[model samples]
Target: MHIVIPIITAVVGIIVGAVIGFLYRKTVAEKEIGSAEQEATRIINDAIKSGETKKREAILEAKDEIHKSRTEAEREIKERRNETQKLERRLIQREEALDKKSDAVEQKAEELDRRLAKVQKTQEESEEVRAKQIAELERISGFSRDEAKEYLVSTIEREAQHDAAVKLREIMQKAKDEADANARELISIAIQRCAADHVAEATVSVVPLPNDEMKGRIIGREGRNIRTLETLTGVDLIIDDTPEAITLSSFDPVRREVARMTLEKLIADGRIHPARIEEMVEKSRKEIEQIMKAEGERATFEVGIHNLHPELVKLLGRLRYRTSYGQNVLKHSIEVAHVAGILAAELGLDPVPARRAGLLHDIGKAVDHEVEGSHVSIGVDLAKRYKENPAIVHAIAAHHGDVEPESIIACLVQAADAISAARPGARRENLENYIKRLEKLEEIANTTTGVASSYAIQAGREIRIIVKPEQVSDDAMVLLSRDIAKHIEDELDYPGQIKINMIRETRVVEYAK
Candidate 1:
């Protein structure tokens, strides 16, 4: 029991001691916390004071910055305002100057208008005076103003024409001395050397029949034979009352030739049937083809031109049957080739190409009747098709003056063609055409101003114009001739150059009282 009591007391004592210790620790903790809060309060108070000092410094700095910025802005504003005032003053001055200029321009314009009105009034007054003077002069001279003006104009025109004629004569004389002599010599030489024969052949071929009875045979069994022949050969058989003659007419010489040959063969064979006519026509076509080929070859050989296309050679041969104004085209072509070659030789150029071009210059004429274009165009196309030289093609195209001749060979071909066609006896026109040509020549001269009388002499080759001595002076005669010649060249299609002769005779035939 004693031991238990002591143990309880000890335990109570230990509990008391732990309670005291706990209380002491709690008091110490509160004291330490209170001291720490006071230290934190002191630090916070110092921070507030430092913050207040820094805020005051910042306010002072901001105030100073605002004052400096305001000062600079005011100074800049004043400068800009001063500049704006100066610009405004300059604009006002310029406006004033522009207004002064406008006023001066207006005054000058008014002055000019006033002067113009004064000048117009003066002109009207002068016109009135001129009208009065003209009326008085017209009354005194017994000539109207229009008639007097016409007379004055005529006089001026005559004088001007005389002066122009003098100038033209001088120029022509100079040109003749420089170029015409050589040109004339070359043309004459070429023409003389190219002496080709020409026989007048027409589109109609006259095939002699054995008897008039043969006409019935040719007409043949309801005209079937003639129809077949014409159909085969593209020729017209004119069976007329002409004794022992049958005319084979066709514009195409090749067809006419074929028809002629067929008729001859049928007559000789004594078998006048449609089938025989067909066979004969076919055979004649072949024969004509062969003849053409031979002629083409002959042309090439004669021209001394080689390497021609086969088709081109055949076309050349076809030209053998063609005619131009009753002149054999093949002969003309051959002559042109010769003349062209001679001219080329004289010009110190290659003659072979010139001759070739001249020979083929009229190549288109061979197929012109069958084609739908001019001979020049057809010839150019054919030459191009045959792959001829470009120079030769150009010559062919330019031979008829269809195109400008650019190459020497082309010009030579042109000259040669002109010479061939223009030489004496080279071509002939029908009587009607000849008379029309002469009449046209005379008419041209007669219609010319101041022409007193005119006559076409030398078979329409020369036109003699007798001018009025008072109207057309001696100096004007040269210009009149030139003008007339130019007119003839432009209007007429003659073979050769025409001669224009101007005769001005002034005889002062007064009465010998």
Candidate 2:
């Protein structure tokens, strides 16, 4: 039994060993298979991860390409849209401009057609009228159109000439008669109204002394009195040259008048001291002022212009001592006022205003030495300062034509001034200058372009210029007269005025035997 047990145990041992080896082999194989499976799984997983990565990259690239294409398409679409809009705007503007052009062309064509139709109608009417007139002319007077027209024109011209000659003669005769009567009336009225003393020559004012011995008193200790008198009066005192008589030498008439009154007072008082001299001068000045006021009042009353400032009245009175071109200023002003009043009444104007303007027209002469401008300008300023009417100021300024006349009254003032200055004996001129001015007047008239004869009449106050009818027309005669007057005014200086007459005559003579 023992033997059998040992054998079995060995067999079991061998079997166990074989099983162990087989199990070892099986484990090895399992490890190898697991390793192979793990490797394969790793390779497959790696390939899948790489494939997904490639696929994702390809998708991203595709998306990027799609975005680029979309952006390009959008840019191209925007360009196309912009181009389309520009074309539409251009087309719309072109269409509007074309419509305006078409309308303008149509209007022009309509206007042209209307004008052409009117012209055609006018031509047709003119042709019909001309034909009718020609036919009528041919039927009448037994003449062709041109011959009948000539005959009619000649007949009318002859008849007009005969009628014009008769009418001209009658008109001239009537005009002469009327002019003579008016002249006579004006002269008689002017002479009757203005009867002032005729001043032949300027006289030197003399202040007589009470006694010959008073002249020594006037001389003073060292002729201080005479020197003071000369200084004060701006005149020379001839104390030694005459006995009981003194001569006042001054260029200014006003100064001479003042000095004469002062010397007369001093002689009457018999006090020849400087204080007495000054007092006498002051008294004389007051007396002169009073005299001026009285003269001004008289003038104003005469002129029918009463309302005036006391100062203005005194100034007007001073004009009594003033002269212009040897014409008394106050007298001239009065005459001008009268003439202006008459003219204003005739012209339907207010005579009071016109007369006032005329009287104050020469107010500048009172202050002319103190003021710088022309008398007209000075008078205008004075009137304006005194709150005179604007029309009156304008008349004062325009009376001498220094300014443009602003009204009919201003022109009337000028006319009155001229008339007053132009009256005979109203102003005086030296004999030599008078004769020379007359000769110059005749010479100037003869120098006219169409003058055939010239004559200076009425003491050189009027000039008559005869012009050849062929050389001078009726209008030319008027122009020539104006030119002559202007030339005389520019070239000559004389008192009063020179009247210019341009006469043109056309004479037709035929021998009747």
Candidate 3:
């Protein structure tokens, strides 16, 4: 009980100390709150004063900006009103100037109308005066206006014709003096150097049989042997009643020769059978080919031409069987080559190409029966394909006057061909046809205007035309010749070229009594 009393007294003392400590802390917190409230009030009053000053400054800046904008706008408007007043004054001045110009233009237009009327009156008076003068001139002169014009034009035309004729004559005389003699000399020499005999080749070849019985045998049983021979040789075996003779007919001379040889061999063998015929035909074909090859080689050797394509050489061999107007083509080609070479020599040109061209000019004739085209076209193609000289190819194309001759060699070949073909007996034509051709040539020249007379000379190779000096001016002869030549070319198919000889003679005579 004594310990409990001491503990109660100690507890009372602890409670009293706690009450005193709580009161002290509460009094300190109240003082801090009072000071914080005073600081907040001062801060709020300072912020309001600063905000009011900033607002006043912004309002003053805004008012100054508004006043400056209003002043600038009023000044701009005043300047625009002044410019508008100046533009209005300028427009009024322009309008007054235009009115003055329009009055001036109207006065000028009225004056132009009055002048135009006066000019019309003056033109009418001039016309009347011109009419009177023309009438008086017509009365004084014998001719009217149109008649005078016609007469003057005709006189002018005649004078022009005379002058042209004289000038043309002078030019032609000069040209003739320059070139005619040399051309004639060269041609004559070429012709003289190459004189070849023309043998008229028969298209059909004649074969002899031993007897009449041979024909029967060749005909064979049911004609099997004959058919086989024809089929193999591609030739017609005509077993006619011509006294132990058979004719082999084919456009291809090689085939004809083969047929002839086959027939001859079969006759000799005395074995008339299809098999025998075939065998003989084949043998004869190969033999003919060999003969042709030899002939080709011989021709090239004769012409002094080397390095010819083998195919070209073979074609030359074929010319042996070709015939033109009954003239042996091979012989003709050789003649042409000789003539061309001679001409080339005379002209100081290379004769080799001339000769080559001349020889190959008719080469196409060798294959004309097999190919489709004129011999000239075929020859050109062959020459090009064989890689011959371009000059040689051109010569071949132009040899027959199919194209214009461009080179001297081509010209030589042309002249050589003409000389070769124009030889007497070189070709054959019906006598009646010959006479008609000559007559037609003369007729063409005679029918022309101003041609007094015409005569065909040189086997229709030349036509001599005599023109009336009065009707045809000297200069007109050239034109006349060309016209007649053109007509002849268009109307007549001829060999070689025709020469147009013009003759104009003016004779003056005065008798002294």
> How high is each candidate's TM-score?
0.67, 0.58, 0.66
Provide the global lDDT of candidate 2 against the true structure. 0.82
Candidate number achieving the greatest TM-score relative to the actual structure: 1
lDDT of 3 by residue, 39-94 (tens): 99999999999999999998999999999999999899999999999999999999
lDDT of 1 by residue, 1-513 (tens): 999999999999999999999999999999999999999999999999999999999999999999999999999999999999999999999999999999999999999999999999999999999999999999899999889999999999978877888788899999989798899888777767776775544554999999898999998989998898888888899988899999888888989888988889999999999989889988998999999999999999988999999999999999888989878898889988999999999889999999999999999999998899999999999999999999999999988777888999998988788878876676777899889989998998899999999999988878888899888777867867878888998889776578888898878768887
Residue range 299-397, candidate 2, lDDT tens digits = 999888976877778878878888876888888888878877776776667888888888889999988877898878888888988888888888998
lDDT of 3 at 327: 86
TM-score sort, best first? 1, 3, 2
Score each candidate by Cα lDDT: 0.89, 0.82, 0.87
Using lDDT as the measure, the top candidate is 1
Q: Between candidates 1 and 3, which one is better according to TM-score?
A: 1
Looking at model 1, residue 418 earns an lDDT score of 80
Task: Looking at model 1, report the run of 10 residues with the lowest lDDT sum.
Answer: 195-204
